[model samples]
Target: MAHKKPGGAQWWIVAAFIGPAMLAILIVNVYPILYNFYMSLTNRNGPRRFPEGMYEVVGFDNYIRLLTQSEFYAVFGKTVLYAVICVFFFFVVGLSLALVLNHPAIKGKYFWRTLLILPWAVPTWITAMIWRFLFHGQFGPINQILRSLGLPAPNWLSDSFWAFVAITIVNIWMTFPFFMLILLGGLQAIPTDIYEAAEMDGASFWQGLFAITLPLLRPVALPAIILSLITTFQMFNTVWLMTRGGPRTLPGQPGATELLLIWAYNQGFAGQGQRFALVSAFAIVVFFFLLGLTLLYNRVTNVTKGAYE
Candidate 1:
């Protein structure tokens, strides 16, 4: 039989099916990013100024200000710390849960799996609100339990360190389930024979985990880790809802828990003066930073995997 190439009609059909989605993406995603980049170069301060066309192109002033400002550096550092802590805990907890569930002797695996994923199933806003109440200063259950136990109850939201801890706890609770699901899938994909071989060779659990499981799991886990890192880096809703990024220790600085997205939001909308241009510059910087990190991560993971192979 002769091979026939797709004709113009087929190409048109393909484009017809893809055109709406492509157009939507361009308008909804691509256009806004480009517009924000353009706005970052201008001195537009507020919504009113945006429409007036009176905003002057300030060039690199906004970028320079963001890069030079102590406040920006503080927030950026805190955001990176938040991402690292959250992603680290997420991996540890998620992998532990997956390992437990993956054990051959475990019963009701489906039921346990379902229950474990409930946190991710809930809306993040609702989870944030619940955690907020739990972390309430006096009447909250956590404090009540602490007082009952004859222990001092620290004010969670009003104190800087506790507020940071509270936000981190809430974020970990809400996000660990996602990592659990991803890691569970990875665990199940591993061949039972590899593990059995390690066991037959008298490998201990920890030895097998390090020698057999981890190396095999890396390929599956790395992408999920990167995704979790990005998600945690841009986290805003849970932090905002829980503390409003508060327990501010410094007079003119962001709250201890104010990650990059929340800082940008405060700059753009929450503060006394709207700093649209500054916010845009911050967004541009964050976009490029994340882009570079992602590229570097992928490159490193590929190199490591190739070396292992």
Candidate 2:
């Protein structure tokens, strides 16, 4: 017997149920991306804005300029470096906390977990602002405490290196809890019997961690790491609030802490002259970069799985 597909009326019923959501997504998400792509091909610098038919098509000039510009490359490279560092620390700190919290001997696990997650729970903008104030060069509490101990307090935001470090510290504090929660869940999902069998076999902690726990956790942790990488790559508010991408290493270049998103914001809105089309090109490049990264990661993951199987 042959099976029939849904008839027009049945398909119409299904569409009736999902059409509104699809329309909403198209309007909210899909349209803006398409518009941005269109804008990237135009010369729509601010004060000479694009009207329906007035904007001049610049072809790939905007993209070519971004690619050839050393400053743009610097910002892109720094953004990648920032994401890598943040994700690495997120995994390390989160996994360590998860292991400690998962320890059978630890009491009041619930209380400690709640306390630890407070930073993640609080509004990120508020946390960023608070950290900014705390890192103030002379009058902040951190400097005050250092002075009480008779130690020199370096200006946190006034120096390029320290400003980068300061933002990284704040981002790590705000983000590590997410990794901790994910890793904790992965740890809990691991069977205690596996550990018991290893213990019975006289396997050392380091040996068991390397041979068993990490291998098993890999499947769970990989996705979380990718997510954290994406989040860190686009991080803007916290770093912007902390330094406004200041303490520049060069006169006209982006500050050490000005990652890709912040650089885009500066070019489009906050710079001496608004370059809307240039920013749009930058956004397109970023989109492709992330897309490539995600695809490459997934492909590698699949290849690894296949090999293991």
Q: Name the best candidate (by lDDT).
A: 2
Question: Model 2: residues >4 Å from true position, as ranges?
Answer: 1-9, 46-54, 296-309
Superposed by TM-score, candidate 1 places the C-alpha of residue 105 at a distance from the truth, in angstroms, of: 1.6
Score residue 246 of candidate 1 by CA lDDT: 84
What lDDT tens digits, residue by residue, belong to model 2 across residues 1-309? 235565456787889999999999999989988988988999887755744566788799889988899989888889889989989999999999999999999999999999999999989899988998999997889889999999988898998888888888898899889999988988988889999999999999999888987888887688788867887899999888887888886788788788989989988888565888889998898898889879867875765564223
Name the Cα RMSD for model 1: 3.6
For model 1, the superposed segments whose C-alpha errors exceed 4 Å read 1-10, 46-51, 296-309
Cα displacement (angstroms), candidate 2, residue 207, comes to 1.5
Candidate 1 structure, TM-score to reference: 0.90
For candidate 2, give the lDDT of residue 246: 84
